[model samples]
Target: MSTESATHLRDESGPFFGEFGGRFMPESLIAALDEISAVYEEAKADPTFAAELAELHRTYTGRPSIITEAPRFGEYAGGARIILKREDLNHTGSHKINNVLGQALLARRLGKTRLIAETGAGQHGVATATAAALFGMSCVVYMGEVDTERQALNVARMRLLGAEVISVTTGTRTLKDALNEAFRDWVANVSDTHYVLGTVAGPHPFPVMVRDFHKIIGEEARAQVLELTGALPDAVVACVGGGSNAIGIFHAFLDDPDVRLYGYEAAGDGVETLRHAATITKGRPGVLHGSRSFMLQDADGQTLDSHSISAGLDYPGVGPEHAWLSSIGRATYLPITDAEAMNAFRILCQTEGIIPAIESAHALAGAIELGRELGPDATILVSLSGRGDKDVETAGRYFGVLDEAALAASALEQNALDANELTDGEAEAGELDHDAALTAAARQALDEASSRVDDLSAATGNGVER
Candidate 1:
């Protein structure tokens, strides 16, 4: 089933999705990529390969991810039925496990003993490391230096799973840099290492293969939605980075012309500003990471630095198929600013008691906007792509929990200093009790923040919760 339904609409054999996808890689890696392509093509046709992979999904990766209707959350979004595809519950805590497991299987088929990958939010890295450990393969993950700091929890998880995590510190020191480093590493070590690209980008069969691996997400969701609602959903939504997860969930609905597909890209501050990764929304087609796709490039076609609060969406280029979809107007791509995404992030947590990754929050933000546009009768299915456990630190910092902690810590240190009679060299003068005074500063700040929240909640009973 899902395989037949997955590719029911278009051709997957060609190297191009319209005019956007093609092998724009180095000569040194063409043969390696071609080898991978051929192997993947063969495996795709082989029933045994499909059977094995399906078994893995069924037993290990957890296939048929449930879709839960968020009635409480939907009330905030113009009363539109908001159903969430719970990919966040998958075994590596994201839809990333779907592609990683399949790639690892293919790598085994190709006799590769190592898995090389690049990650942005580190979910992909964690998934790759997980599959590597499961299949007894060595794993190396490259991540941007900036991402490593924000996603320290995932970095620790990767190392604990036996992956050697390399922090890439080039250019913007984000996803693009890490991808560049991973490609370089793959080119040098193609003999025994399989570059498990985490998304539906890169060269030929990868976009096809990775999407095929994840199409089960849409396939299951489609049937589940129909079973639950007794009709098709009015729309489907997902956040797009290199575009694997979006493609996975979007593919099954492509044949249903009436079902709208919406992809949300990261707009760090605003699209008007230079700091955004809304590739499909504010980009032109250009080659990046071995394929021609919508890229944030300059007038002279040079790649531009992209920024987003979500490391996963901080890429300058998008998957080629997404370029095709946008070009054809089959799907709509929108920019979700950091503020919008964070607000939605807080809403989903307060409303549904589910913390989502910042990347997925973009889609949540879009859903609210789209739901209002479509009104109460429509049903929108949003992909909760990943859990927020790996993102808790970043979110906490964003919400000022870290600032509060630092203030309290500093206040306590000041108290310790005052007790030691070393209060800024005013010990003998005794001008003030530095401990209580400093602690009060922190307390005052905390009180002010609490008061603000309380004031808003009092004004509108539902304001603080959502």
Candidate 2:
């Protein structure tokens, strides 16, 4: 890699990166999308809107999230200097907050009364609910049944934030299905509800708009790295599910030829097997969630199911920009297996005292590989996208760190910790109304899920379509 700058930007003529992104959705959504696009374009140009958003970033979402050098962890990575962009330290404990706060403000600007979103690991759901609570907007989040199970604490957190969580039981019970449900809700309630997309994927304006919201990750990291190292990083590494954080960090460095960008995808067992979500590495261009992108699909063109130990990265499609970036040789994408990611996750926790989201762990694994190949003295900047508290149960099971008794004890300790975090007065006033609504919604969703499961079971046994 040469220490030279190579600059490029996506085409502004339309909502596209090369031939990738565009409005490939139902006509019913066009007006809503156009409205959003127009408003966002105006907001982007207005100093007042920019000032307000900047203030929110500073006081509300914690702007300029610090970059921490991970020397201990770097010891394991071919002695390369590893630095983490600490997005995990932000409010809501993830980079998701950066986008949600912007979108929530936009939603309020559009006079939307309700906010709806879909989540996989529930980071986005929790972030959206937090923003809704802050903005006093009604909120609803759709999550896959399997995801709700894997990320139960986040489901609880979203509920506690006064968001109704709907469990989608259809089709693999994961992010894609939940997204389908969210879009359905958005179309029906387009007049009053704004769909706060969780990532840099989806239709025309969404791919562009969400990426704009998260660009701060790269902008800040770029300035921070330059000040700390007096040079740009050798590689900018981030995990790619829907590719938000990766794109966020990658965008600013795209014009810097010397800064290599690498995106790691979740390879469950391996990409050669049918059980991974390495879309850019193993998939072809296809339409999913209204955007043309790399998608895991069968010969018949049906989308294939994606699997990963990390709920966040289990998706068949990728953000369209990732596909474009790969095609133009601007960025390199690779796969990191579940075992590889888990090992990196444990190493970071033990060595650096940083428990990263399993999704971010994929990037850590990639950085390790890149570090070895690039040799010592190379600096790798990895996006620590979210905190791993949400994955403690999953990680505990993976590492056998928590047995049944220990798990129970841990749960009790967590409950107590959460209780102590709330004041007696505020808890009494908020918990009553919030808990009642949350409990009712939870029960209804569970009952509906059970009924669907029963129906599926009956249909399968009788050889009928459900």
Candidate 3:
């Protein structure tokens, strides 16, 4: 069978393939998952639930994000036509809100009083917090200590929205660590708290639930593309962090046999350096973060810390759905390096006036490569997963504005810089003066971020008060 038929052959009901997506949680949480599953099943069948969600989408979360044609960026891809699903325009500034809102609604239906989630880049944290605030539910977010520090602004954003942020200092102090903390919290508080997973990974219900929530991305884009150009796209492209956005768009195109699907994973420094997060492209089957999938591990089967310029994709294992998709030959997984993603980041900024989250840049980079192969007439759709506001400092450092010499002298130097080593005048003249530039860059970043957020809010009619 062709890839399309194979994907279509599988129904949305039961019979999850190969035990890849069965509930693997502690016995305590099984009842909650069962309750959630039942509620979801009812919601799926009931027109009232569907209408309410549709109303929220139309008024709260923004359905039907725009499909923008990137002509200039497409030129580098051998003149192939390239379009972007502007999920970055979604409320909370990423594709994350789509899943969060849906799950939050599900939580409300389940009669849960609190929402809990784990985050790395803080995008999901912010989205979850936003939903909780909207629904008037209590919220708690667990983030790795390192991520909390690196993404302090997001931490503050969540706090401002009345969500509690706990910094997990265990393990590698990243997404996995935060996830461990969240899982522990879930096991302890499963009855009253709903764990809103950010991606289509995780155990049983999550892979299916998150995917169903995100499927709107592809559903809306499919119709939009057809309306805009009168035909199906030649291919769909998305960055695969936990494979949420990729699966979202890909699910819609699964039955469209001619429409190719490509998912790009992060290759932090360089895959050749062995210091990367290209899980699907450079990993083995192993268990990590509550799911069995492609994982970066050592000879002893111990999980390895992953590196990526994009914190969102800095994970050692990918979503189980992605693993199954790859094994079934339904989708192709590729790796995009930090350098390539950064380059694409700048290209989108310069050419299209769009600054995508570093994570989304990976897909943009892949689009460039695939476009070249497809040439000018072919149409490819890429998901602009989020905005880049949360990554200015990292991007500046990667782009050399915050290089070693500058870091040694800047305000960010702080404890690392010796005050006596440089005179006041010298310190003032050197990296410290870079503050104005940093501030300007930060403002621009935030402005871009808010614009995307507003676009999503407007589209979804979510009416984000922020």
Q: Give the Å error, residue 270, model 1.
A: 0.6
Give the range of the ten consecutive residues with the poorest summed lDDT in model 1: 457-466
For residues 323-349, write the lDDT of model 2, one tens digit per residue. 888998989999999989988998899
Q: How close is every model to the real structure, measured as TM-score?
A: 0.87, 0.86, 0.84
CA shift at 387, candidate 3, in angstroms? 1.0
lDDT of 1 by residue, 48-156 (tens): 9999998999999888788989988888788999999999999989999999999999999999999999999999999999999999999999999999998989999
For candidate 3, the lDDT comes to 0.83
Q: Which residue pairs of candidate 2 clash?
A: 6-257
Report how far off residue 182 is in candidate 2 (Å).
0.5
**Over 4 Å off in model 2, which ranges?**
1-7, 10-14, 408-466
Please report, in order, the local distance difference test score of every candidate based on alpha carbons: 0.89, 0.89, 0.83
* Total clashing pairs in model 3: 10
C-alpha displacement of 293 in model 1, angstroms?
Answer: 1.1
